[model samples]
Target chain A: MTVLARARRVREALLGGRNQTWHATEALRRGLLLGVGLVVAGVLAHNVVLALLGAPLLAASVLALSTKPSGTPKVTVLPVARTGEAGETALATVRVDPGHGAELLAIRLPDKGNPGPGPVHLLPASVAEIACGLYRRAWGEGVDLRLDHLVAGPDALIVHGPMVGREVSRVLLPPVRELPAGPVPARPAGLVGVHRSRRPGDSTDLRTIRPFQPGDRMRRIDWRVSLRSNDSMPYVRENHAESDADVVLVLDTRFDVAAEIADWSLPARGAAVRPGGSLDTAVRAAASLAASYLRQGDRVGLVDLGRPRLYVRPGAGRRQLLRLRNQLVVCARSAGWSSRPVLNAHQVSGGALVVVLSPFLDDAVVGATVQAARRGNLVLAMDVLPAELVAEPEDRWGEPVRQIITLERRVRLDALRGHGIAVLPWSSAEQGLHVLRPGARRSR
Target chain B: MGRVRGRGVPGWRLRAAVGVVGALIVLVLAVQGVTAVLIGLVGFVAVAAVALPGSPAAMLLIGVSAVATAVLPGEPLRWEVLVLIPLVHLLHLSCALAAILPRGGRLHLAALRAPVRRFAFVQAGAFGLAGLVALLPSDRADPVVEVLGLLGAAGLVLLVAALLRDRDRVG
Candidate 1:
């Protein structure tokens, strides 16, 4: 391409855009055609009233044409909140600058995951700002707004666009419920935390009062206890060492199923996880447990059974909670069936509470849970399967299919219990609470 | 399409409004006893305009209304023909605006102000023309009346030009 040719091409492009930006709409065509045709016909036929009526129609059309838009309007979608929780409404503001001669503006706002550009909002061009509110229906990252806009000249005679604006995406975090799990089990490792460790350390929970030996600091003496004792030795109060435990939440994204048995095999149309589906429940459950453990000063991490690349290393703090929730969206975004579940020994630390969240629909997930249990991790299998199974209305064998699924799931749960893995329903209130009890520490 | 009665859709009610305006034009033509074909075309345009405003049916509907006004045998200055001017414009305005916002978001009243203002201004001007036609002496087809008609038309054109210039000045 020569420079002259390139310049020519560029000129043609600009000219083409200018020409194509404004096209006569149906209303414009109607006005001009009828306005001209009627006035001419009425005049030649000697019918004056007809010509008079045609005058206004002609004037309006001409006015619309005369006010030809000079510049192509620029449309921008500014999402007010780039991150939101499921079931929350997110707002986005759409702005357009039609420059001049544009009368009306139409822009599509967010609809609930509706295909295409969602809904169109027709407003006058003078109203430059448009507010679109979209309700985030489900968890996971999603495109919040696909702003499609059109600018039209007065009386809607000529239109400038159907020009599509870039999609304004948002990360919809999964809703976190208060998962009341058992107490934080004592770990002997960390120097400081909320839970008791086997070794004595600085925590309010007392271990025992013992006689002060040599080299003990004078501040260690409990004078009241020392006076009560007849021995010559000064007594000191010893407290259990407060240590933090590591909690690793394993999420099974192998399959997503809802209570609706018929729709189980159907592909999710545009959703990462079906609302209230097994995978959704599992993600939410994992988030809740993570929040609980983190609040208790324990380190919490995430392991994606289907995709190990999404693994989050155990960490403790407020920042860790946000990291886990954000990572959960990424995990669910790519949730699908993989050959074998990957809950490797290295993914979980020694004595970390391993909570497996899955529907336990297939044997591979069950086998993985059993392997984690055998690897000496404290394992709890959270059954996230929705209990209220809805049968297909029209299928003749719906009841039989439901019964088979229920019985098979029941057998799986029993098998998991047989392997010494505590199987608890996700809806259970007191799950993992026993882990906090004195001497409740158990390893596979 | 007209089936877009979704709750969240903006301009959800505009389609109904456009349909009403289209229907009114059709009714006027029907009462005037114009050709059935023209009336039928107007009727189809009414339905099509609401469902697919971007389609050419709206323009065709305007043309049919104009043709109906031209050929109707009654008084040339009958109020029915005079009314079609604004009705067609309203249908056009409503249809075009409806097509802009087919579906989502809440329609703020501010958004409709400019277009509605324009619609009203154009209609008032059109009705003003109708008033002038009523005041004129008689039989519009007469050559003397033709010259006056031509002069009034020239004045109308001049007025539109002045408005256009005024818009340019404002810009």
Candidate 2:
């Protein structure tokens, strides 16, 4: 690298990240001093005895000017790890050096899917000591820690800390291949197979056998053995088999509700998973869910129903899961961009399950999800509820306004269910996966 | 920066400059107060000549003494008083100079350490002598004035000690 490039790199490394710079207001300081001096001069001019006092005042002003502070300390953040795992710490070291003396006020670390209890403050210059082992508690079972603010310097020193226990996984789904516009034939490789331990009736292998159970189907009975023994007890068999259903988790990253600042307007809503923003939360949740499904011996993929049309091919293996997670974390989506411009559900293979995780805030994304369901794919829509529903503090406005807003959110959710899509409204009180599901009336 | 071979300024020149400035300040004060200018000038020059042989700053003490005497309310001019002023100035100057410019006699470690010890000892001795003179009952001045004179002498002793300490560190 050239000298300029090296210098720029060094400057960036020292400063931590780009920030606004402030200059000392010397003119203001001088003006205040001049006013005080004038007052003293006026008081001393009354008598000859007091006239000598002006000499000391003049000396003091010159001394103050000569002893002005020289330089201002600055902080800059450098390269940071793009991803981290849940229940594990991600290390982010920042350089904090100052041109002159300064006292560090506070440093704000990103919420690793968990709400931080309080801000951390380091040792002052006079103390000049450092504590090594510091750790933050995990937010939930699978939440990614996100770094937020780092403040350092008046004295130049680099401080390193970890963002502990957060969910960081990548998902890459296969490109959506168009299905032929004709009668579909079952490909031999795509056929859903049954376990072998059970009697052969639509099965390839025999599944396990057990004593007769209440819910055992009669058609699965071995009649020949029953006649020979004149058996009074009937035996039942259990089948453990893998399904051929392909699950495509469509994550909406258009407008995340978790991005808004939590204040008096937003109450102590459970642990904030996406304090960085809603888009980040959606991306993280989608990645986590994709990994979870893939680990269960299922062919899983992802479709970001936002801008740029991020489509990872359906595949199995640890590497494919990582790739998908990486893509989700780094991809950016435009606000007004619609998913309808890219995807159509009729093009998907039969028996595939399309799981759409969205806030359902946009008409285009919602429309695309409905079209996917109509195409014969087992569609499961996981509705990401707006954080504002629970985030809004009840005391901020009168109870009536809060109730109205809650009622309106419910109406929107009901409208989504009306279209025959399973909706899940996320809540802090329960696990996001199990809390909200389609009711009997809505599960068409 | 250009490198010069020897000590930057000659010791005699520094001595002469300090002596001249000291004498001039005393002369100006005497002139402004309408005191006998000849007496003040002679007293200043005598002190300078004696103090210059030792360290330059001794001339400052000599000048201060002249100023004190000039400001004193006394009979204007006496021939005996004029002689005594120069004699006292010469005695103080000789003692101070002797402390700086060592006399060659013994080649012992004690002789080598004598200059520093003598400098401090002579400085203390000069203050004591000045104090004795100021304290003596005199028809010439007030007792309060004598006390002030003693205090000024003590201040001179402190000045000499500070100068000696600085010179010792530099050497």
Candidate 3:
């Protein structure tokens, strides 16, 4: 570019167009006025000491003002990962090209309940680049970052923008912990599956000995049974075939009651998942269950009772597990308090094990779980509600309110058990799975 | 672009430097008179103002100190007065550094090089002028002519500043 063109561009950048402009900050204006006033006063009063001190101030202000900052520097923030695993660190870099005359660059990132790296101030330089590191502490889609860039001129006399930049949205996947494989259905479908099927086909386990049919394999015939029969009829041994079962995870997103006593009174948005909140417990448990079932070569699907639109078809394999995890984050993100919770029968496959994860705060969730169980699906209502309750301080009738809610919740859970649907507290997941075991009868 | 971060001078370090300079100024003033010490205390208050990241109170205090020194009864000219001028300039520079830099901001030695260089030039000029003034017979120069000379110098500085301000760019 020609020198004249370069100069023109610099002027335009300093003056700014409609969208961007350079303006003096309060500090800068104060410095300029004070510097001039003191120096002039020193000269008029014939005080050499004062003039000497004031001269530098005046010189600094003039020098800062004279050096017009180079054009409005555009800040470019690199794209961050769309999905992050809990405890994983993700980096986002912001670059300012040809960063001439930028005295200070202030970069602000987003703040959720979890502490994020604070704003960084880069010393003035020709080219500045800042890399922000974010730590994913919890599950669910957290609005991780919104970049705000502010550029100050020399001596910070002139500043342009605290311009709001693009917001970074990150979906933090729930950490899947080690969970023991739960009980599988007695009657499984499909040719290749993990569970044993009652209907004999081709498997290692022996089923029953019967007279050889027309299509019976020759190898399956039991010679001892045939010799004992003495009726000249060969008996064929049948083996139970191993098959896979469908596990449909039903997430109740109506209300996320925090387990912590102190967080009960906080605003719902911030208090939605207080580390060990009911929703957090549900999401984590659901993730663990899905991973365990999928690892067993079983088809797993997901259904959010709060949002019917988000539904995952029954699928198996590693890809399905990833899809289910992503969906879980979406499910938790939209798991706000709802008045009416919906659970459709189409969401559950016949003979499928339906695990309904809910705090059971609302009677509607309890009704949905019972309805699913009654429809011939084995429903396990995982009570994610904390055992103890803490009431808000300002609530005058906190004790009475707690007592009433607790009493109602107990009755609802009893009703669910009365309908043969297994009501289990999520805290004791092993006992719940034991209850669902077909061969191993539960004592309860 | 690659990641880049520069550490400028630390705030506390610069503030401590200014505090030491203030203590020296107080000691000098105490030797002069109790009234001068009181004036030094006032200047210290202004130093407190400059310690804030963005405040102009330092300038007012500097003006007050200059007036106090000029009007005070003393030997018409002294070598100590010349030394005090640059020392006061240094204090102002330190205060400005403390004020302009962000809190906890590390001062890049590179950034300080230019300002410190300019300050050295200004100090050299001031010392040269003081030397010439000291050579003159203290009783020979008329007080009116001395004031006129100071005004002429101030005018010359204003003219230079105006010319510099009009320039399209600062080098």
Candidate 4:
């Protein structure tokens, strides 16, 4: 289906009919009768006496039956956000306009079949407004509202209401996108380097010497080696080039790592992180880097080392990017930190250029990055910190605690660099991922 | 709180309560002799005047009660008694108008207009004059006056029923 059609469907599903009322008509009748009956009884008992009191009661009855109510009120629904990562609050607004002098006694709004009661207020004749917010806990389609006792779902909105009126507006939120595998990067123009060899080919550089089989090419044989050994021998040769690097982007969704800027001087001292939390920043960074690398034709794959592990096998094309983006959005909603680590030693077997995007506030993730690099992968660690952490006042906490945390961060940074892993620190305000390559001459 | 459903009191109960109350009030007034009987007759005619369908029937009942009160014996006609009769008739008329007129739009507007208000005021003034007339002295000592007083008493009972009936139907 078309994007607009799909988006429209999503809107209908999330913000549909939900405005029913429960009026106590019977109770009112009972109260009226009881009051009248008591007065009549008292008059009969000589408890009270009046010249013509009974006349008003008779008149009231006639008037009550003759009056009838007017038309039902007009309502409008507006979806605030759609396609939010799991755990983020999606806000929707419902506006109603009761005709002149009309009074709405009550209103109800529900979520995906679950009922949510709303506050009712007097609207100026022909104008009323109600707002609703829902916390998306799972990934799926469709959301609906409940009015009075009636279930007003997306189908009702689409069928009953005029599609063009100001009554309703449906919004679809697109999912977050991360990295995916693609082609290798092209060699930079005018830069000369030894070409990497997957199999023996025409190459001047000697890559390695190993025991050869019968299929070994004669051209690759070392004649000088045969003379020294005094026996028939062969060599398998290969060359490494700068363009052959593979980038494996690792996105951390662990709780210990604060993905957002710290509101407090200390990260751990703030309120518990909410659902969307800081993971959105990591997802955005991963997507941008993956796009850049894919443009250069470098093989790119994404490893989501969060609670629910997500792996996108190395591939190329616009379709792959879209698929990866969809997955990222779903992951943002569902993934969380767990007791067990998301990545283990066996997952990084085939060496590739690894890019780990995380805040590095957690010890577990820092260890995981170091382990991946030790396995001979070209690992680039992109550390995402909230902008507030850099500007927080030092007096907010004891000087000793601040010194200790900073010292620990420094130690961790040095340890990663010592093990030859590139570490780039990033904040929300930063324009792009900061490059943390080894030497000054080889800056990213 | 428990749910509210249906109309107020059960229909049968409401009808019974109004009927019983009307019967008892009329019975009590009848036992108070000629003056009480005259007042009771006035109450009954007032109720019937408002509740009954025909305005002419109510006007006839009012005339009969007026003549009976004039000729009645047992207690002489007081100034208050004279003033009360017209006042009661006017009240009955007002109730009848309330029943016949529609409650909304132009009818509602007319009900609140100056002419209607003036009419209501005139009826109240007539009733006050009758009450003043009841305070005046009168010399009437015949059995016809007694019989008239008895008929007025009966009319009073019917009027009470009419008033109750009107209330029940409208409510």
Candidate 5:
């Protein structure tokens, strides 16, 4: 058979008779032909028993044809949850208001018949709601589940559609691990925030005890200190003002290398980013840190090192956290190398904690991290490389090649640490940042 | 991609069940002196009916057996015809459904419930008619009844054609 004929046969087997309203099947013809032929032949032979044998099929044909399903079936596809974390299974339902005539429904779903991915499902039309478990393995914005459906009439004698349902595109956010919250370098400007500021104000942290100021509240006075003074000089305690920190999450989208050393050179195949790759790790790490800082009432922002157009300005609140996470998705979606990683000093304030998340595959990112450090910003270089490297099985020299690459990368990371930049690998990202208590990470 | 499937009846199980029914009917017809060629024909057609239900082999399996009963110069009111009537009808009904859902498909048992129920109802009515037919004198040759059966068959074929044609036009 020709390829077209073969495809049509396969399609009919899967999704019965596409795009047409319910019509007769081959069985209908078989029944009518065999039934009438047997009855007529029996009469010609003057045999009453022969005529009786054809009665059942004749009755079946009439019964099947009589069921004329009335209304046009309307199919509605809805995902119970539009957004979910990567690797999470979400439920998507395809509801068919089979109107009057539909008997069977054939929908494309991720089912056993289709061994690879999503494909056809044949079920009774009475089942209006078909809940399919849609799993998105990769991160970022893309189509999660697509329902291509059709309807068949009674006895599967007729069919109505093979219409493609609207694609259930969901924003599969990169999974955010609840990392330990760490203090960011608070910019001296903001007057109210979680961190203690140098300028004395109405925070609970006591800065010092000195002679009572004219504007000091009565609550600030220390009665014990006033009693201790022989000169009758009253002393009041001073508290530091609270300030919010600007956390610029810098993502290096240059190299999205996976753990497999062999696949490192390949562009992302059939996926936005390679699963467990450098870029995937970076996006997840950025989202986690953003959530952590924003939870602590600090201003969080995003800087896409490769594509500057995707930069999210520093803002505080729950919404900023969401925007930062979404921008991280956009970064993953359009991830590629542009001009070398950019981190101009003006992109962030003087004391903003610039957490540069990269795989450390190149010195350019290391140099950018060091440059931000030199610009008086507390820069933390987050190495988001996959923890384990897998060598190609067939290649004899693969292990040596991976070893050489590993040694070079290790030296690069060590160089960044030597420049006073805290190199926090993704595995220990939040843990190492906790050491940057206030002025600890700031060299100047 | 998320793959989902529920508890289902395999297509082969239905085919095999009907194949057994067809085998019984074929064996009953094949027992006319129980020849080797007849036995071979029964075996091949029975397998084809299940393996390729939509193919001409299924039609031949039922058609050849029914024709053999009529042409074998046997008594018209034998116990064999009564048994063949239900078994052959069941095999045909199963093949029709099995053709729609091949081995590649996931067949839910519920999908077959309606068709089977209808088959049972139709079979009940057919048995009632067969019981009535069983009372008729075997020696009687009614010319008027034969003419009426021929006319009814012709009218049915036209009516079926009209229904199918009307459906095709609207579709």
Candidate 6:
């Protein structure tokens, strides 16, 4: 290749997708202008000190101008995990093959990702690895990071990039706090589980004596009961077997309510569920319940009423729990106010315990919750609405509107309770469970 | 919502350091009367450059201030001017560094070691060259020779700068 052609090829290889121009930085311009300007002025005026003062600028200019960075270095950013927990830190890395004469490399983590314009790192020619730390503060699916890179020549006078970097996603699962998986009514459809089944089988709970059948194991024959019978028929004690139940977590993603009730009138863009908002509370509660039940070896499933497309089938294991958590994040990301809340009969299995988490802001969601109870599934409606609602600043008739909504909510809750569906606020659900447990004292 | 948290070094601290250094240099030269105004203006610009460090205005200020400090007509060569040189250089350097660094970035002292060392070497060479020039036999120069010397330096700077400009297509 000709010299010009060869140089062009080399430049292309080095810069990759970055803008190839070696632009003058503020440092270079300052050095050149001040250095030469002072030197010439000193010579004209016969002032030695002034000329001497300009030497560093001259030296810097010379050093920076000696040679241009030769080739472009391609940076490959590694993919980060799609899911993480709140307060957890995930690590990511970028790799580069050093371009010719490439001296200083800087990578900026975009502000949209986690936060901050990450770190500025100097790369040793041989060491091309750059690691980034991503800290997840709150739950939700968010852009993990977008990389912005700038590569400087040996003296940092000439720079090659401020180029837009690649963007990656990171989903953060809501934190799961320790919560008692309140007493769910016995619906032992599965043969193996943690809940106690009333039927006779191998378990700790003792039941009344019954005649021993042919298939009954000899070890199960209660010698005391058989001898006491004193009849031809042998009597054996029966015990309840440990069985599992199906728990379906029904999330109502129809609306994300902020604490200040007046915000409803404002633009919905800023109307995201705040840290202690209704959706946040519901997500935390659901994660806690899923984790607790799954740990107990019970089957747990997830259903998004707002977006039925994101349903998770009932499963048991650590991996399934991870899927459920990730699915929950997806549900929250697409969560919004829908015209109607959907809870198809097929979503919940027969005799499954359906826990419906909702703010009950719309009449549609209330109807859906009641419909689930009517379908023979035991339903627990978690009132995810904040206890206090603030009046909108712009609305002149705010107080009356607040009172009317409050009255409507109360009536809807009462109607749910009247229909044999358990209606309790999220804050009270755990405590209510503690109260419902047999012989368990209710802690204030 | 777009605000970034967890910065390793606060940006304000870097700006403050640059401002303080620039102000001190200008204050020490305040005795130069009218000349002090020009230096003070440069100092003010330097501080403003903290907020907008990457702009060409900073480079122009550095040049103007250096010339102002040098061209004060009546004053004899003072040693304090020597001290002022490094401080001004540092002000320009710090402002430029602060401007280019990403938000929330901490200074990497090790990465700066080379640049700082190069500057220190140049500074020492400058003082040495000045002392040597002072010791040389004095020759009264005609206006022609002065103009020629100035033109020669300017020509050399331009030539070197042109040569340094990248000729090949940028990637």
In terms of TM-score, the best-performing candidate is 1
Q: Which candidate model has the greater lDDT, 1 or 5? A: 5
Candidate 5 stretches with Cα past 4 Å from truth are: A1-20, A45-54, A77-81, A84-95, A107-124, A127-139, A142-147, A186-191, A198-241, A263-273, A337-346, A436-444, B1-92, B95-108, B125-140, B169-171
lDDT of 2 at A125: 20
Worst 10 residues of 3 chain A by lDDT: A110-119
Q: What TM-score does chain B alone reach in each candidate, compared with the true chain B?
A: 0.72, 0.29, 0.71, 0.36, 0.81, 0.72
Candidate 1 Cα errors over 4 Å, as ranges: A1-20, A76-81, A86-96, A110-118, A128-137, A181-188, A199-240, A431-444, B1-10, B35-38, B103-107, B131-171
lDDT at A219, model 4: 65
- Model 2 chain B worst lDDT run, 10 consecutive residues: B1-10
Per residue, candidate 2 scores C-alpha lDDT tens digits across B1-171 of: 111121112224323443554455455445445457654655555464535443433433433343344344553233322422432333332323222221221111221132234334433543444345456554556667656655654553454344323221100
lDDT of each: 0.74, 0.41, 0.68, 0.43, 0.75, 0.70
Weakest ten-residue segment in model 6 chain A by summed lDDT? A435-444
What docking tier does model 3 reach?
incorrect
DockQ of each: 0.29, 0.01, 0.22, 0.02, 0.30, 0.31
Name the fnat for model 4. Answer: 0.00
Considering lDDT, which of the candidate structures 2 and 3 is the better prediction for this target? 3
lDDT of 5 by residue, B78-125 (tens): 778888888878877777766666465556767777788888888998
With a 3 Å backbone cut-off (N, CA, C), the pairs that clash in candidate 1 are A119-B103, A119-B104, A120-B101, A120-B103, A182-A432, A182-A433, B9-B104
Provide the TM-score for each candidate, comma-separated: 0.82, 0.38, 0.77, 0.43, 0.77, 0.80
Grade the docking of candidate 6: acceptable
Give every prediction's interface RMSD: 7.0, 24.7, 5.7, 18.1, 4.2, 6.4
Per-residue lDDT of candidate 3, residues B55-161 (tens digit): 55555454555555656677535544555666666666666555544454445454455457766776676566556655756454577886786776677467546
TM-score, cand. 1 vs. native: 0.82
